[model samples]
Target: MISEEEQKKEGKNEKLLADLCECCIMLHVGFQVSPKKVTSVGVHHLLKVVLKKEESEETQEEVERAFLALKNIAMWVKIDKELHLSEIKEIIKYHQKHRNLTHLAYQYAWEFLIHRFYSNESLEIIIVNELHFGKEAARKLEELRKNVDWTRKEDERGKETKEVLVITGWMKTIKSYFDSCKLWNEEYVELIGSVVQIYRTAKDNYEEIRYWCVFSLRNAAGNGFVPVDDLLKSGAVGCVLEDIRKPTLIDEITHHSLTFFENISRRLKEKTYNEMEEAKRKELKRKVLEKIEEEGYEEIIISLHERLNTLKRKYFYGDELSLNISDYSVNI
Candidate 1:
């Protein structure tokens, strides 16, 4: 009994419902999180865009159903900072109280906590400021800080949280040391020293200390020419050098350093060769007539031709030579 327009509308409605359901299912299973959780455009706008073609009743029903489903389920991984901060706190408390701190939910909360803390400096500050005895998170954080030197009166009283904060801050700036050829070596060194010091002081668990040590080592190694020999002499590489020597520790440091050295050497050699080529290119013009007169141009040309053929055989083929423009020149 429906008209053509109505049937088309119904199809559109079905498609929209299917899409919304798909999105909701993805959200439930913990996937496809929006990059920036707090957008200028509200959730309502997102809903509008997603449900644009659906019938009002179908859209409304789907939205309500999805919301209800979410209400009953606990969020595992959330990109939404505002929702994440408090909801995860409540979840942690529940897990701790139930003596289920080792449960799936606990691990999930702890993982999210690490991710959320590392996600942004400002978020980290907010979470740290909100931490206290009443919230079981304070104890968890205290555990995380176990390797940090809390023996100092200031650290014990939480007055000197700056050391812990510095280690935390290094995560973001550490990457800059890798990409920039002119990156300050001192900054990288200081960061490594500070992070290691904090880890050692914290008396953190073996894993925590190991984690920071690796981070420090990786950041330091990323700088192509770290004063690694000097550090070894100073005993700074003592803890991690053994780790690096181990094959299972990962080859990233060695690989990164080798690649960096290779790139630098390649560029330097290329530059030197280019300068030599330019000088040769210039000399070839002046020497063209003189060399041809002294030595028959045909012989010179023949020799060059042979050299070019050799280069082609080596580089162009399976051999190791490379041909250049100068390799085939003649006086004429």
Candidate 2:
């Protein structure tokens, strides 16, 4: 029942949408290679045009292309040091309005923003305004942790398993953001309590969840963002040492814990202990040394050294050379 002219117009629109999608794909690839150069005035203008198109005016293909373009632009802001505040705001608005309908689009858009503005304030805004990471998130995680029966297989939980998977994925994303930007500030310091609580709750729940907790803790504790005193007070160090001693713990967890310990130890060793008052210096050194000794670090290091010697003996034929003198036929 459609007229020939209307059919031709629809066909043209589809073709145009396809072309735009192709252009976006190319731009994304180019941005990956050299974002600073690709995000020039011309490209920025074209992206803005694409972004301005309303959902009603855009075909599904066009909408996807626009989102892709926005994501690339957002990523470019990270390396270029260019402030695309207006464009970023537009992407956020579009994502907020359309996230439920297209989750992946919103996800890439959200990540782009996170990477673009690598600061504690920006992260807090994303957490509170965009991701809503507060009491509700805490409540949901707590509820999921309560419902999870780790005695049974993860697959047996059905709906709860799905929820746990989603929550853990979100945790990993947040952890990655924290890892990428080492924001040492009061804002991040405040997050230590919530992070530690999540860590303790998720320790026995899922392997991936626990790994992320340790990874995030390592990054947070690195660069002195969360002070050693604070971490020790939170019992985070004890938890990490316990995890390291777990017979079934994954290598990733062990590696991150070791790195965390090394960072803390480096910080402690760098302290101006000699410059401090004698009593204070001795007290601080005593506390640190006592913690290290209580954690069985001396035994752990000795064991590692013995294991290394055993490996050397096994592989290097230590102090025992085996040569085929008969085949060599006397070198002289």
Using lDDT as the measure, the top candidate is 2
Worst 10 residues of 2 by lDDT: 323-332
- Measured against the true structure, the TM-scores of the candidates, in listed sequence, are 0.28, 0.55
Worst 10 residues of 1 by lDDT: 37-46
What does candidate 2's lDDT look like per residue over 1-332, in tens digits? 11222246444443444344436445565433344444443244445444544555344445455555655555444433345555655665665556432333444445555655553345555455544433333444455556666555666534446546645644655565655553344444445555666677667646777787787777655655456666665566666777766767465565566556656665555545455554554465566567767878656644444333333344331122122112111111
Q: Candidate 2, which segments miss by more than 4 Å at Cα?
A: 1-83, 87-110, 117-186, 273-301, 304-332
Q: Could you tell me the lDDT of residue 62 within candidate 1?
A: 52
lDDT of 1 by residue, 18-91 (tens): 34544544454464434232121123223333223233565545544433333222233334566535655654
Model 1: lDDT equals: 0.38
TM-score of 2: 0.55
After superposition of all CA atoms, the RMSD between model 2 and the true structure is: 11.8
